[model samples]
Target: MIDETIEEIREMQTHSSSVVAVKATRALAELTERDYATVEEFERDLERNVGALKRANPSHASLYNALQDVLHSVQGEADDLDEARELTVATIDRVVETVETGKRRAAQQAAATIEDGQTFLTHDYSSTVMEAVELAVADGAELTAYVTEARPRFLGRKFARELAAIDAVEPHLMVDGATGMFLPKCDRVIIGMDCIVEETLYNRIGTFPLVAAANEVGVPVTVVGSGAKVVDDGFRFENEIRSPSEVMLEPVEGIELENPAYDATPVDLIDEVITDEGVLEY
Candidate 1:
């Protein structure tokens, strides 16, 4: 089960990074259930598995942080293997709870920034941004959302469908290239990030250009996510290169095809990052 979850995360089968972190952390808890001859043996296995999980998706700071919390707890001095195992399980539960709670609070902060009768341009699929829109609407704010196609995956289709379910949001679906064409009509550009490492926002492939266009049009850009995504030093961000088949079912004879899973957007282009703590002015 642990190996399966790791593969799911590496393959991007999990939609949200927060969900990825939770699932990865819970998978490590499975390790605690196994029989170990000594506390040292259990700690050894834990470290090995933690390294593998982090390698599955290095761009996921939440996953890295969650696993780090568990590893740190288990590595502490314990009376016996049983004590170490119990501590590991407890740490996993605490980390998962924190990730979920932080996400909800961040969404609330983002929603508070939404004013009634405002239009937003969002790229890709972001559960944080989606929840913010829903919360704002529930509070009686009418909103309009323009979502991009987010090509190679069409994640935006999922975003648009969810927005359409809300009674007060007007959802518009457009190709990724049409961002500039519609930016003039948008009041803000709201999105989510995989991680913020070294002050750079790593997100969906088209996010950099979208944010750049939004900045050019003088529209404020807000990134909504948990603070766990703000990675400190020692964690590296690696963008996954997907299969070319995702971009084209049948490749042209001589043309080279490249499919990058994410892109880095400079922090200067963003107006603020709203997390569980509050809005962070960059």
Candidate 2:
């Protein structure tokens, strides 16, 4: 019954953009009503909730890709699920690969602006940023990189672990709130974006603060994103907020709450946006 509900909610998340998190939240709420009092049950419930969350927002590429991962993981051993996941992962990999062709552009631009062996700071976990770092490392640049532990999900820990596993760039894990403390240690800032407006990029919620801090310190920040993430949003800004349950599993009665998933770094904050074709300044 729980799996059935999860599948249904997943479909709903696929079709609906605004309600993914809410649907995921309610599904877990229902599971709790079943008196799923065991730790395993709670863990399963948590997974489904996050899965639904991925289904919830398609506008944000990272979250949507994360949702695809959830589907693949839940049924990893099943032939059908494995096939679907492979196809999806392949598609994303192709897109990332194609976009990363622009890294040369960044590298060239970076050479003009930034020297080798310069440390940098970034908030949110960016696979694009990782790719760039890897490219720079391959060129023998010992760059120190800071990744934020995007909390409520602790996705940043995943980044730190992956970086350590790479045996290349230096990856430091810092709480989102403490990014300002380390901004001075880096030469410049770089982040991967899910979407770009002008030169600005949209990413995880706490990304805005880090960008702002970097800007105030007179550091140039670069945004890297794929053209596929570009859509006519028809708005100056878009922010994806997460479910309140992410922060409060058990809230006080009658208390209002808001949990947002993401925010934007204004176009003015970014120096340029790097894409596959080349780099753009908007």
For each candidate, give its TM-score against the true structure: 0.97, 0.62
lDDT of each: 0.91, 0.59
Instruction: Report the C-alpha lDDT of model 1 over 1-282, residue by residue, as the tens digit.
Output: 789998898778896899999999999978878988988888999999999999988878888888988888779667898888788878888999999999999999999999999999999999999999989999999999999989989999999999999889999999999999999999999999899997799999999999998888899999999998997687888888888999999999998999999999999999999999888898
Worst 10 residues of 2 by lDDT: 13-22
Which residue pairs in model 1 clash with each other?
A: none
Please give, for residues 1-282, the per-residue lDDT of candidate 2 as tens digits: 435545654333332221232233333333333444444544455466555555444445433433444434433332443343344345434434433444444444443444467888776566666666666666767767787888777767877887787665678898888888888888888876666644456676788888899888888888765544444543344455566787889887899767666676678777877765566675
